[model samples]
Target: MEKFEQIFKYVNEYAEKLVEANGLDYLEALLQTLEDTLDGTFEWQVEGANKEDMRKAIQIAILKGMRKSAQPNHQMTPDTLGLLVAHFVEQCFEHRLQHGPIAVVDPALGTGNLLFTVMNALNGNVEATGVEVDDLLIRLAAATGDLIEQPVTLFRQDALEKLLVDPVDAVICDLPVGYYPNEEVALDFELCASEGMSYAHHLFIEQSMNYTKDGGFAFFLIPANLFESEQAKQLHKFIKGHAWIQAVIQLPENLFASKAHEKSILILQKHSEHLKAPREVLLAKVPNMSNREALAMFFEKVSMWREGNDQKR
Candidate 1:
């Protein structure tokens, strides 16, 4: 980890130097530096050291440093929550081998942590794409992809304005928190007719659902109080009409580095006439412990539920 930090620091310094010397854009300089140094910076001659290990190290190190230096986006999913969300996605694909090599998209992919984690959990058998409004975060995410030799298409467009032409297998995101001040952007009138547009997170969740194919999943880490908020009643009503609620996992408070608000991961499957919706949704709460025990327990519970479903079929 220490070595990784050193490498990341060197890369940062190199990018800054390039910016100063060439008068290049920050993102362009960083991209150039990453392309030139990724191979040499992580070269490890130690026995059993492989490109995969180097790639993981580079991703973690750069992500840690970038998070520290870059302007904070409270909307970004915390690492722990992101990992758990990724695991849930992997579980969704466990029994569906026919869809083995699925597509996962993150509409608000800050640093691409959740997106890449999902790819890793699936053992690199999936295609990953992300759309981020922030240039710096997207650059760092692209650099990580370059290092790992993994292809992840990142669009610079705002997620609110961009709609997917081709639906995907899963829509996974840690929605941007707080209200979206833009009232001009057209939204589902039903979501706004009752309470008007309140939070941007609500719109993002809707976008996630819309991005998924029939019978596909959309997972979001959102404010735990969302369900109780008066402004969200319309959002819930809209969801009831269009999607099947699958699971709601409450996360521990302070799981995020920026905010301590209690959060939850909501899993929804887009409305599908051919696939029957679950009679009862899974609602699980994780204890506030930082250990991996809580995640293991959650995984076990989900596995049991899935197995029961298989038996019924």
Candidate 2:
């Protein structure tokens, strides 16, 4: 752990230097520093470091840069939450893992942190795709993928815009919440608001499900009041028509600054004749993340649920 801290410190310092020297944004500077470090342009020697450790090192540096920037849209998914999502992915998609490499996409791929975290946890047996509109973020995501030697294809465009990529086995995203600005674009979506701006998160869910192969799963970190909003009735109807709700795991409220900001992981499987809805939705409230015994019990319940769910397939 000390060695990991040292690596993070080195990266953070170098990134800060670049930010000052080149008058660049912290995230851009951080990207350049990571690229330079990998190319031997930077003199940091990381001996006996595994890929996951190296990735975490970079992630920590990026987190600091994000704090310095303080942009709400630039928020990276917290590592704890990312790891939990990865665990759910591994458990739910165990059958796909047994067969071969699985393809995954993140529509709101900010900094690629959540996507890469899941990819690394899967031991790199993944075909990853990320969509982002920000130039710096897409570049950072691409560079981070190169540094980690993970093959990730990225698209630089509005995530809600028409995607050219093919459908994948699974979809994962920390859904970008708020109103989507393009009212014209929103009109094309089934979940578009009848009289006002549509929720981007709702539209993203629709878009994600569209790109997913039949019977594929989508794991989304959605707002806690997802079903309590004014547009939720339409959203609920759309979902019922298209997919099966597998689970809704409420994250610990303490993770956020306030109750209103709390989020939950919603797991949905696209509708297919071969796949039946789970006998019961796995609705759960996570305990404080520091409680190891509680967390263990929680996952044990997940394991038992998975076993029973598999029998239905």
Best by lDDT: 2
Query: Candidate 2: where is the Cα deviation over 4 Å?
Result: 311-313
**Segments of candidate 1 deviating more than 4 angstroms:** 1-32, 38-76, 193-197, 257-260, 288-295, 310-313
Residue 282: error of model 1 in Å? 0.9
| TM-score to native of every candidate shown | 0.82, 0.96
Question: Model 2's lDDT to the true fold?
Answer: 0.89
Q: Give per-residue CA lDDT, model 1, range 1-313, as digits (tens).
A: 4544555566667767887899865555656767676657533233454444544555654554544454566134445776787778877777674556888888997767677766665676778888988877787678867666678888987787756536888999887877776666635434543445557888787777778898899998888788877776778887898898888988776565454476788999898877777766888887766567866786789888666553122
**How does candidate 1 score on lDDT?**
0.71
lDDT per residue for candidate 2 within 1-313, as digits (tens), equals: 5666768878888888998899988888888897897789986766776767777887888777778886778788988889989999999888779888889999999889999999989987789999999887888888888877889999999989899879998999999999999999889899989897999999999999999999999999999999999989999999999999999999998899998889999999999888778887899988888999999999999988887886256
Flag clash pairs in model 2: none
